[model samples]
Target: MTTSTGQPLAAQRILVTGGAGTIGSHVVDLLLEADAAEVVVLDNFARGRMENLAEAEAVGGDRLTVVTGDINDPALVRDVISGIDVVFHLAALRITQCAEQPRLALESLVDGTFTVIEAAVAADVKKVITSSSASVYGLAESFPTTERHHPYNNDTFYGAAKAFNEGMLRSFHAMNGLDYVALRYFNVYGPRMDTHGLYTEVLIRWMERISRGEAPLIFGDGAATMDFVHVRDIARANLLAARADVTDTVYNIATSTETSLKGLADALLAVMDSDLKAVHGPERAVNGVTRRLADISAAARDLGWTPEIGLSDGLDDLVTWWRHAAQPAVAG
Candidate 1:
């Protein structure tokens, strides 16, 4: 669904942390399309891109302000959050980065998020939509993992931080009456995807290699799968989470479909119109998880949201955008 169809958050002055990053950019774009009174994007450009904000800026005009600052800066967060109606916090260290630097991750994800919530509480903001990860599910033992799953498996520092943030939300909600929605996103990929972050989805890394006429490499037997969702659909999810009546709750943001790496590679090849075969490599233990598919019933039932882009269509859209962006421009 297009952003215009959503219930307008009348006179909302929203703040989207990391608003220039891959998924965050889409969030900002949709907020503008839904006619938020103003959208203030707070990002440090560590992973965020300036060009990503172009579309939002065009639509937002004077209503959009891009703040250059880190989330760990409590002072900056407090100042930026004033007069904000709601917040969509997406800024955080990558999973791999968090794994490599635990201390930094602690301060960034935990302290950083705490700072956001604290500021929102002080400002008496209306709502908060936190972007969490599916990593917390950690080697699911059941199909279509539901929100009622057991406490997060001690997987990685990134997952730990996400779980901690959820706790903080619940506590703040109980104590200070904070209204928030926590979304655990699955293996998300689309246009403006990042490969250097945490775990590079084999889809992107493979596409990069195949575009260079190399084989799409798969780890293990390529039997393991992931529930992939498009960034735009995720953007839509963020919007719904922001406006929906659902509060003090968590939902899995996914399309409820699993596609193996082999399947994903084949889809990529077909999209690129290439004939290269996939190369299977030795399996590494770090690749974790045999398969994953989210139980999206809660999101559908509570938020009235469902992902529209399927695997083939989403990958096609992603490949087209990536290919155009990767091409060298001729001198005008």
Candidate 2:
């Protein structure tokens, strides 16, 4: 989707908390593509890149504004929320990294969420859509986990934080008049996803190893599955949530299909045009029930949003971008 030369955002002032990360940047892009009046990006640059902001600004023209700040800062969050029509809060420490730093995870995920909701309510923002995660469902006994699934065992601090935040969202919606939407995103992969050393996403790690003619590493039985949804589809869902007139609610934003690690390895090999296979490594023991996929029927019915990008197509785009971005000329 392309925005007009100017006035891409038409008139609504949309604030994207953590707007410079992988998923958040795409949300900013889609919001601008819809021609919102203004797109305010709030980021601390702790885990986000400057280029993500630059990309948003380039496409947003004058509509994009970057606030280099932390979400935990109530003052800054309130200031950004003031006069904004909608808030897409996508800021948080990720799952793997949060596991290593449990305390920081709680601060950023749980406390930061409370901060955003409070600020949004204070600013009287019309709508708020915070990013949730499928991790909230720890291990699903069923194949396609629905929103009605039993509360998670909370295998990690990250998942526990999300669970706590979901409770907070419900509380805010009930007591205050804050309209909110919590989207439980599945395994998201697309362009601009994190590939930092030892902090890369699983799909990204697989792609990088395959690019270097190395066999991808797999832990456990490689049978555990995840419903991988593309960031573009997630971006569209965020826009839909903001535009739709709805009360506080939660929805699973995912492709509604399960892809196991073995399958993912095969897909990557096909993408890279390589014959290297996956090598089983020492499986890190993780607590929690396994098997996860999203039952997104509620999302389709309520938000009129469904992820259209398939894993293969999404991974293809991601690998292509990664390959180009990995080149020396492109790097500097």
Candidate 3:
């Protein structure tokens, strides 16, 4: 669980909101494995599942404590922040959900941010690493998107929510001297991704389709692409952000390699050893990104973060997990 640099990010105590999620669970596992003294996981099961923490609990033993609660509860957030050295804030509603219920979704994000950041500042927590999204770069003006091109590229409620979170963090830092970092994660793919959503990650849907002997569905032309970083890599980036000597800045957490939907389905087919071809579907998205690839140079230079799993290796791990996850045990 030590970083790739071999340095342990051992903490006396840690609090991870949404800790029972796809990426959050991996963050918990890595934190426990890296020898954190104690870790408290808080989740409401809105989009989180207890099964996601089974492996982490098995490894962490008494060192891990799970709490089921709402992140929007200011008092609850305050209580959870007490005596914690670090916080990884991953609680959120999905973009599709945000689009459907903008009022509730937006309120949840704004309310949750105030609760977590206020509690952290009140408790004098050492650092907080928050979850941002590459969707903030809607229709990028250039390839290799960087943090500087944000607010302009923000075109979705989901993206705006993340950007608002970042702005709050900066304001907190400026006013109260809160230490924080935000990672703008790109299209993350791996095991345990939420499989029930209508807009579930294309890769997960494709895997399920292949399992059912159905052809993978391609929405856009087979050419639109995204930077699909593994969830494990995303988890590792959080650790790096927590342990590194940087703050009040954002970093792009991605592999910087774009994979077309066709390429992804082909990769999955190859990995699954399936011969099924992808079926073409109507251009489903009203305003979908045609391409996105991040510039991870800042993460590398600042936090010593770089993705270790290549697409094929990541796909192999994902397929293995998917095959075992035939039931809905893990969270999104």
**Per-model TM values vs. the true structure:** 0.93, 0.92, 0.94
Model 3 over residues 1-332: C-alpha lDDT tens digits?
62221223585699999999889999999999989999999888888888788899899999999988988998888998899988999989888888888997776787787789999999998889999999778889888888888467667888888988999999999999888999999989888887765556767777777877888988767898889999999999999898887889999999999999899999999999899998888887645678889999999999999999999999999989877864632322
> Where is model 2 more than 4 Å wrong at Cα?
1-10, 286-289, 326-332
Candidate 3 wrong stretches, greater than 4 Å:
1-8, 197-199, 328-332
Supply the global lDDT for candidate 3. Answer: 0.87
**1-332 in candidate 1: lDDT tens per residue?**
52221234657999999999999999998888888899999999888888788888888899889999999999999999999988999998888788889999998899999999999999998889999988887888777899988655558888888988999999999999888999999989998776454445556677778877888988788898889999999998988887776788999999999888888888889988999988999997764778889999999998889999988899899888877763322211
lDDT of 1 at 145: 92
Per-model tally of clashing residue pairs: 1, 7, 1
lDDT of 2 by residue, 1-332 (tens): 84211112357899998898988999988888788889999988777886666666888889999899988988888888889978888999877789899888877888888999998888887778888888888887776788887665557788788878888988998888677788999888888887774566677777767766778888877887878888899998888877665666789999888888888888888878888988888778754445677899999998899888888888889888887763212110
lDDT of 2 at 228: 86
Top lDDT model: 3
Question: Candidate 2, overall lDDT?
Answer: 0.81
lDDT for each candidate structure: 0.86, 0.81, 0.87
**10 residues in a row with least lDDT, candidate 2:** 2-11
